[model samples]
Target: MKLVRYRPAAGEAAMPGLIDGAGRLRDLSGHIPDLAGEALGRAAVERLAALDVESLPPVPGQARLAPPVAGTRNFIAVGLNYRDHARETGMAVPAEPVLFSKAAGALAGPYDDVVIPEGATQVDWELELAVVIGERVHRADEAEAARAVAGYCICNDVSERHWQMGGTGQWLKGKSAPTFGPLGPWLVTPDEVGDVSALAMSLTLNGEVMQQSSTAEMIFPPVFLISYISRFMTLEPGDVVTTGTPAGVGMAHGRYLRPGDAMRLDIEGLGHQRQVVR
Candidate 1:
């Protein structure tokens, strides 16, 4: 099932929802509080999947979407996890996953405007596959880590390269800007997603293809990354770990985003996201 969090109108509280078989949005608010915390666990998700989708009230007209999962305490990220991405930057592939964190506040609706931080130069895009953890786990094995996943979604790991590489070189500074993390269209379950490794993903800037690759290119896939991360920090339900982006970032071609530039990111099965740079 495709779960979502959305607002019926501006200033309204976000309500839990799902996309039914007919591709219509149906309300799940009565069944759950929000799509976060324990609601993201495997057993909880399975219970939700059993509900009669058609009987739920339809969310009329267009509602503004929020990131699929909420109450995320840790918004972790992997860097140089994609081989082509590493190559494009002339950086050596790390034997282990290079991890970083994006402030949870940076999360935004998929179609929200990506405000270019003031005085920022070298604003860029990194289209990534985001994983939402379903249960608390630490020191998990690959199989256990795999089972801990609740769902997947698309994430735009928008960046400010100058802050990322300049000064003391703290990656979080460049990655944690407001509106920097645009996620979701839906939080698709694992059963529906099938083979996560084979999904095709890409990003287009102003209608032109900029990044294109498959999860198959990832050096440390989701399960491995999850397990690796668990060895250090305990991952909780609703926590998000964004697997790194593919090649073709703006930095490689000196084509950073400017005001009015639009980005559309697509990950197979997870759905797509559109954001206008402002």
Candidate 2:
């Protein structure tokens, strides 16, 4: 099932909803308090799928979409996990997964404006598959990690090359500006999404394709990343773990974003996103 957090119209509050088999959205706002938590329990997907969508109110076609999940306490990220991206950045493929954190404030809706900071000259785009954790786990195993996953969504790990490389070399400062992490079109459950690792991912600057690669190229897939990360920190409900992007970022080609640049991103099965630099 594909789920969303949306506001029905201007100034209306956002709430959780399910995109049914026919593509219409049914509000699930009151029924499930914490979908991430519910999705982790035994027979969870089956139970959620069993909800009577027909009885729920239909969401307006023009509803403003929010990132599918909210209250993301830990916005974790993996770096250089794709071989081609690592090569383009001229960084060695890490022997183990590379981890980093982005401030939770960076999260934004799929179609929201991507603000270009003042005096910023090197903003960039990164297309990645972001995993939304469904349950809490401390030092989870592979099988446990797989079950703990709530779903997947499209994420643009927007970056600023200047701050990323300029600092003491830490990535968070450059990565966590508000609206940098634009996520969702919807959250697609694992059961509904087949072969998560082989999905195609692409990002286009305006109308030109800038980054295009498959998740198949990931050096460390979602399951492994989850397991590895759990060993170091606790993974909790509603937390987001964004896998690294592939090659063709603006920084690699010296093609940074401009005030009027438009970005379009798509991930197979998951969905697409549109953003414009402000």
Candidate 3:
């Protein structure tokens, strides 16, 4: 099911809805008591399935979208996990998963404007597969790690090369600008999406393709990534983990985004996103 958070053009309120046949959206929040935990689990989905979608309220075409998940505590990310991306930076392959965090406030809807920090010259885009944890997990094994996953979503790990590499080597400092993390058109559950690694991911700037690669190329796959990160930190419900991006970022080519540029990103099975540079 394509779960979304949206508000009609005439209203500013946000609520959950499920994308239905014929592109119409049906309200899910009122139908499902809880969007988190078991309410989002398989049993709850079965309960939702028995209901008549036509009975639910219809969402307006002019609705403004919000990121699929809200109130998430941590937004964790991996860096240089792709062989090609690592080679582009001339950095050695990482010995372990390179972990980083983006402030929760950095979260923004998929189609929102990506702010070009004033006097910032090295802005770039990294299309990644973001994993949304559904259940609370701590020190989980691979099997448990997979079980803890709620769903998957797409994320543009927007970065500033100058801020990322020019000053401190800390990637978070360069990554955590406001509205930097644009996530979701939907958050799809595992039942709907069969295999995560089989997905293809790509990024286009101003209508030109820049990055294209498969999640199959990822060095640390989602299961391992979840297990690796859980060893040190608890994976709470709604906490997000963005797997690394593939090669062909603008920064690697010394071509950065300008005020009028637009970026469109898609992760197969997950959905697509559009962001305009401002």
Candidate 4:
């Protein structure tokens, strides 16, 4: 099931729904009140799928899309989980995942604009696959970790290099800019998404292909990440854990985003994201 959160009109409330085959939003407001709170689980989606599609009221015509996982508690990220990315950044491959947290305020719709912050010159794009956790788990085993996964979505891990690599050295300062985390076109449930580790991903800046690699190239896959990270922190439902990005970032080539630059990110099966640097 492909789920999304959208506001049908300017004043209307953001509602969750399934993206049907014809690409229309089938409203689930009548069925699920708080989507991210409870119905975001894999089981919930499967249950909704079992119901007659024609019964659910569809979101009327055009609605503005929001980040699929709304009111997300924890927006976490893994760094350099892709070997090529670590190589490009001149870092060693980690024996364990290098984890970081992004402010939930950074979350934005898939098509939202990414505003390059003031005094920020080295803004780069890291196209990544973000995992949405299904259940609250702490120090979970591999089997439990796999079962805890709700689904996946596309994420643009936008960074400001000057603050990240320069200054005080907290990557969080470089990340977490408003509108930096462009999340999804849809939150694809696990059953509908096959082989999470082998999915292809790419990022293009202004129609130019810059970053291109598959999850097959990931040094640490999703399952291990969920398990490893959980050992340190409790992952709650609706919290997002974004897996690392592949190589070919703008930082490797000294290419940074400026005003009016357009970036397009694509993750096979997960869908695509478009953002203009503002």
Best by lDDT: 1
> Global lDDT of each model?
0.93, 0.88, 0.84, 0.87
Two-way TM-score contest, 1 vs 4, winner = 1
TM agreement with the true structure for every prediction: 0.99, 0.95, 0.93, 0.96
Clashing pairs for model 3 are: none
Model 1 lDDT per residue over 1-278, tens place: 99999999998888999999888999999989999899999899999988878899999999999989989999999999999999999999998999999999999999999999888998999999999999998999999999999999999999999999999999999999999999898999999998899799999998999998999999998998999999999999999999999999999999999999999999988889999988
* Of 2 and 3, the candidate ranking higher by lDDT: 2
| Model 1 segments more than 4 A misplaced | none
Candidate 2: what lDDT?
0.88
Error of 3 at 266 (Å): 1.3
Residue 224 accuracy (lDDT) in model 2: 89
- List ranges where model 2 is wrong by over 4 Å: 34-45
The total of clashing pairs for model 1 equals: 0
Clash statistics: count for each candidate: 0, 0, 0, 0
Supply candidate 2's per-residue lDDT for 255.
88
Regions of model 4 farther than 4 Å from truth: none
lDDT of candidate 4 over 151-223, digit per residue (tens) = 8999998999898879679989988999989999888988889788788888888888998898988998898
Please write out the lDDT profile of model 2 over residues 10-100, one tens digit for every residue: 7766788888879887888667654556543437666768877788888767788888887678999999999999999999999999899
Cα-based lDDT at residue 16, candidate 2? 82
Cα misplacement distance, residue 6 of candidate 4 (Å) = 0.5
